[model samples]
Target: MDCDVLVVGAGAVGAVAALGLRRQGYRVRVLDAGQPMEAPTGEAIDPRVFALSPASIELLESLDLWPRLAPRAQGYAGMTVWDAVSGSDIRFRAAEFGLDGLGAIVENAALVSAAQAALDDVEFGAALAAVDETTDAVTVTTDDGRPVRARTLLLADGANSPGRQALGIAVSGRGYGGRAIVCHLRSERGHDVTAWQRFLPSGPVALLPLFDGRVSLVWSADDALADRLLALDDAAFSDAVTEATAGRLGALHTPTRRFAFPLRRQTAERFTTRRCVLLGDAAHVVHPLAGQGVNLGFDDLRALLVAMPDPDVGLRAAALRRYERARRADIAQMSQGIDGLDRLFSTANPAVSTVRGFGLHLADVVTPLKRRFAEVALGVKPGFPSASG
Candidate 1:
């Protein structure tokens, strides 16, 4: 098999797909733009972090990638959500969901490295130049000059996937007028092995507990404020963080590595095109309010492998219709949910606050409903998977 599955973008999603696909008895090849030119491979830690769903953990565990990630990753028992203005709060625990841990707070670099190291088959440093879907198969070319054909092409190149565009997939994007400013901060108080998200008018400020006495923070704010915060000195930064989060984590001090990215709601017009399928960020990118972006990608990885044929497409129509149909509701629901949350807490009006706070209060008082909510938010509950129906 020259190429059983060709994956574009060797990021965490692409690496995981390559490993999982190869292990499922499919030959796989991966291509990346060679971040080595801009970022040293030795110190290649993606500043962004991810919250691995429990199902995602199971998949990683089965693939033997979890153990490799465990050393560099930190596990959280639960998360707390609050309002920066009104202080309306809701807490979800692993125990409430009948799980040992709510989820894992993993550095993006750690997951990428674990995913990469777990794969023995991949072609890094090769950015994709072209993707053509023929009558029978898909052909891919790389910048460093490597061409391969696979019966099925997996587009994991991320939100700005050029391969997706080259294949003429109409990707529509909508922005929330916000940016995610991320950095780590040393804490005086224990994050108590817990994750925290406070919804403010600017955006959300999440404090995910890390190894040692520190936490990784992603402060999504209006674009202008995010730019100014990124430029603040260490003392000013910490002071702002303390005030914004209501000093819950306590005595915050900004750690090294500060960065920001535009926030948006974008999805491809078609998730699958003939022999080509888009997965991971290539398919959709939503607000990081839920932190389910990569977990959603992992779900795709699992479903695609489960839906693959005995060998390859091999005159088969790829069964991608089944994949698309099975996954659409879940994707649509989540996209809308995130958009609603973005709007809910982003307005500065008092009427909006009162209504939203009352809703949160009602949710807090409702026991069974709250448990169900925890199950979904913490990624413990079995979701509507592409293979479920």
Candidate 2:
């Protein structure tokens, strides 16, 4: 009936946030409405794996989620970005950045399951009926007709957050004519735990190698192509993906059932309203080209934990404003950069293609610039979660 902190949503961000707050000496309660998805996102395998940056790993590690996740995780010591249409690509080595690995490829459901297991206690299947903010505390009523009272409420409900709306927080976002086709595929050669991304005329295709001989695919393509791929049978679909990706993985075979989600950019104008604060997808959503959506959520987790006030309401409006302002530029830069990259590479013009190819080659040749990217991708150059320098 009551808790020191109440988190709505048991997805990636919400689970992590609840665990973080609980570890901070607060009595935390989590409410999740969706049936906890088990065994990944497909019949054959889970295609919804995440490329966890070092920052995310560190955050989870601190919460003791990484150790439980290590057995299932696939680590990449480097990453390669190539232009499929043009023979241009850039290689990023973790060694160049003085890190052990570029990042880790983690199955999505596995991650939350691990995080929840590490947590002391978390309640599921309770839909939040209402969230009412008061001067001193916030009261949340659940579908089961139970009122969960908390000194502070964190809403991590997700991109199209009902919690944000119920709490009267203003959110802003717009859709891009892009959809991502995701699935798992087997390769002849081992990926060596390396992450690969190729930018095509339509959009970007990312191949994150898993522990086994398979790789999870995230292909951001145009609307029409997405529909076609979603409709294709398993056999035909594999061939289409391979052709679109140009057989980069030495022939992608055995594609599991595919799923697609619309792409969009969303950012809440106000991070905090009254006693409730927005975190994760509740705050913003960015293009997945750079794989920054969950990474942004990790950033939110770190910021809130590090800056939480003594009392839940101790978070001053000015401080919350500062946090929102600080995050705006980074989120905006990533959204604009990814959106621009999609626009630049999605064109069919000969001139634009030629220039983009040349730019890729330029990045490949520049050692310093390439290393900088490696550091950023490792998620530890600076301003990352907890790891410094």
Off by over 4 Å in 1: 35-46, 312-315, 368-377, 382-389
lDDT (Cα atoms) of all candidates against the true structure: 0.77, 0.76
Residue-level lDDT of model 2, residues 1-389, one tens digit each, is: 38777888888899998888777777788888876646343344566778888878888898888887787788888788877667577777777666677678888888887776666466778888788877767898888888889877888888878888887777677887879888888876677678888888888888888866688889998899888788888888878767766676677788877888888888887777667878888889877777777878888777777666444433444545555665677667656666677777777787887887887777677766554454434344522324522
How far off is residue 141 in model 2, in Å?
A: 1.8
Q: How much is the lDDT of residue 55 in candidate 2?
A: 77
Clashing pairs in 1: none
Alpha-carbon RMSD, each predicted model? 2.9, 2.7
